[model samples]
Target chain A: MKATREAYGETLVELGREHPEIVVLDADLSSSTMTSKFAKEFPERFFNFGIAEANMMGAAAGLARSGKVPFASTFAVFASGRAYDQVRQSIAYPGFNVKIAASHGGLTVGPDGASHQALEDVALMRVIPGMTVIVPADAEETRQVVRWAAAHDGPVYIRLGRSPVPDVFPQGAKIQPGKASVVKDAKGRGFGEMRPEGERDGLDADVAILANGIMVSKCLEAWEILTAEGIKSVVVDVAFVKPLDEKTLIELAERCGAFVTAEEHSVIGGLGGAVTEFLSENRPCPVVRVGVRDRFGQSGTPEELLVEYGLTPGHVAEAARKAVRLKWAV
Target chain B: MCREVRKNVLIMIGTAGSGHPGGSLSCVEIISTLYFGVMRVKPEDPNWPDRDRFVLSKGHAAPTLYAVLAEKGFFSKDLLPTLRKFGSPLQGHPDAKKTPGVEVSTGSLGQGLSMAVGMALAGKLDRKTYRVWALLGDGECQEGQVWEAAMAASHYKLDNLAAFIDFNGLQIDGRVEEIMNPSPLADKWRAFGWRVLEVDGHDVEALLEAASYASESLGAPTAIIARTVKGKGVSFMEGQREWHGKAPKGEELSRALQEVAKS
Candidate 1:
């Protein structure tokens, strides 16, 4: 198990060695956000932004505009909530080439509670005119997404986590932008087998589970429970929230008559919101959203919070079953 | 040159049929001095690596920056009349991508200083001598981000950056002191570790000297508190809060233009 924020730091160090133009800025949260690793390796290239998230964001914009690629790191809450105006005006409005690697996202921020958790970051960032919002599933995916965001010449917000999650991909697995990865495909064959395109065309899956962030692993677990119950399902991992994987979504919608979206974020305007907006306009599948409901989180251990917020494997399996029932009932 | 910029401000806002003429007119001298004489910029090469950067933080005063850029030959004066028009490069706010010489996009308050600090930091990192300047409003300083940027700039010791507040003492509502006052302003900025310089903003020579001094100051960012009159160079609009966002109409325009032309 590894934290995505650690992967982000390792990726920054690697990228710093390769790209001289790459600069790092952190709002006095370097140790926590893991940007201190980059600062130690490249002291001149790193800036201690001194608890000023807004300035860090605006400075990242200025540096980007002035022919430098900047990666601004801070807590998810401060990066999005405290410096939202700076992000909106200086970075998004101008479409500057800045990478915002925000750590400690979602309820897994744990004992820090809702004040530190960023449930609305994806929604806030994706609604902007020119912002690419990304929430990686695990450490390996985080590294690939960081490299991608560094190379891409636009504003990007990459949401990372504080707690460690199980690796979902192998070494050096390239993450494609705006494309969903099928981690475990249980359409026709048993576990860990994919259905051929020809067979997928005729498939009406028992349920399709679309998951992002740390919840992807839980969804994979939920798929196991559902399959043992004699239910055939598909599990997809979505890292990019904007410029969504429409082609894959259409295929999943066609294969599965019902859908279930699982995320560690808020049910309102996260992965669930994006999937629903797409399917309601195109396929009209019944979707069960498994996430934090319309409410804030409280202080607790990360494991307990996951269960309390209904984001555990049991919750995902229940949501998938309910979605399938609703589809059949209709 | 200041009069020329004022003429363009009146014409641009008057042509657009809607703009903040009072604030635009108040910043004429500071904008004129920086573009024409103070800043080391090549109008033909807006993206020159070693050139000084000018950020118009108080974006409502785009007319002032646009007119100065035109006068300094960054772009054609023909675009001056196209301010705020559809498909026009001259937007309602200064867009660095749209305009030739704009350093960064700024309209929202308290953001330009931070951008300038970033540019200065980058210059220090690259060992470049180019200076960065951000023009802010007295009212714009009320934003908390300004202080944040101020802290960062001083913390980083970005002496290569200079910011000026167009202290016209008026905003959209009423007197700035009355509407969310930031009094003891000079002391506050001094406490934030800035080398504060108070100047008569309308005096082009004094503005030029203060800016020149700021460029050479070592180890700390400079803030020039430019005391200016709203609707400067005009009789009826001067110091009148009603003119804060209103453009001069037909008769008003003719009279304001004639009065400014005399100066």
Candidate 2:
């Protein structure tokens, strides 16, 4: 079965049940954000602020003052840009325990167009002091990240996509905050130590594919095609975007020789830009970013836009091959 | 107590050379009535967690709050002379960190009510009985965030919270309506799900009655809209928008003091 970002809502409700201090806040998009499940079970703990995102941010800060861990939900655009000042002063400046659970992140919020799609939310939120930015790969990873955000301190921004994709991690996989999970290897044949049977680990490769959100599944698919063409590629699921697993990135840069970053956000300040900033100082390598260029996306189906913007599995494979060839040319 | 507070407010605003005398004098009786008669506070133990929380959301009128605090013995009465002066605890606006009795730092408009909501929610969660009160300027209602906070307070059923709207009929730019109409204000607040009460602001007995009603009213937030003149008691400054931010000079100060003496 395919994984969906809505699975984070199930995990969030479960976490709220376990911790009495946990509260869920929604801005009239409870069903959309999947927080309605928690609202149904915990009516008293859930707050529906009726289409006011700014007030929701302020109320979340207020809830934090009362020692309640508030998880505020809305579409990514309003959560980041609409209530930017409120989040800055009330939650970020005071360092409140508020988890901004934003769904429909990046261009994956298809058909809603540019107004709803949150392309620069990651960059805008990550720069705030004491803020934890996480972009999980799939539903299971999103669940783990949500649980981690509750256990962690200060403010956290969790980005979830609207679409469903294949599960990259097996059952019973645990997620740690500020740590990167290496889902596929490029240099070796077998998965790292904890490989499930019948799963091929693309370890022997000249370049590594670093992807986040729903793009992780695309990168894995591309890795298989690249391996078939005799161009081995390692796929790293960079779920934690803020604390970009420097150790794993450095190791991959040294081993793979080149890198390709794929995400659903703008190429200017998304996962690709973060990877470039990391590699430029520590391990300089040939890099190709496969994502939205510096332009707003119009209304279209998710698949159409992905192909139009060159964000499919085939695109990743081509980008990986081009990055490897560029490294050799250098 | 209300008369004494009015006298001090007039004196302080008269000498400060730069203070909001209109709203300050308009809210003098309400502030004095709340501080002296209603609120459960301590002069020395200002940060006592169990004490009731007061947030002056219309923070531009610091003279009213300063006068009340002085009368409550939070500080010496002599400190009133240092109002808005260099190195004075009494700045143009109320700074919670600098002043002794201030609950939250409020200078920017429309934020104090939100902080008061936070305090009330804190009391409910901690199982404390301390009530939270926020004083707002009628003109400050032009801010959208105030309505946002109002909605949350009602949705949360913060019966412990009460807000006082100083309907002094004037802001910096002429009357509130001419600047930006916020009329039918009581109806607007009622629509947002608050128990609204309208009262004569300078009437001490009526102010006490409205506060009593708020205390007894449970299961919803309360807003007491006190109607007042731009500047009360001082004949020269009364009903004048110029007095909203300007202070009386050397000769005008003596005349204002004399007017207070006669009252």
- Candidate 2 regions off by >4 Å? A1-4, A188-206, A229-232, A246-258, A278-287, A321-330, B1-51, B54-128, B168-174, B199-209, B227-263
Q: On residues A132-230, what C-alpha lDDT tens digit does candidate 2 reach at each position?
A: 888888777787788889998889999988888778776557555577666777544322344564443344469988988889988888988997898
Q: For residues B1-263, what per-residue lDDT tens digits would candidate 2 score against the true structure?
A: 65677778777876777888888888888888889778998889997777887878888878889988998899989999789889999888887657899765566677778767767776786788888888999999998989989998998889989999999888888889999999899999899899999999889899999998888747999999999887788899888999888888888878887887788
Task: Compute the TM-score of each model's chain A versus the native chain A and list the values.
Answer: 0.96, 0.94
Model 1 misses residue A261 by how many Å?
0.8
For the record, the alpha-carbon RMSD of candidate 2 to the native fold, in angstroms, is: 5.6
**What DockQ results for candidate 2?**
0.28
* lDDT per residue (tens digit) for residues A153-271 in model 1: 89999999999999887776655767888877765342234455466532456888889899999988898899899887888888898879999889888778899999888899988
Off by over 4 Å in 1: A187-204
For model 2, what is the C-alpha lDDT against the true structure? 0.83
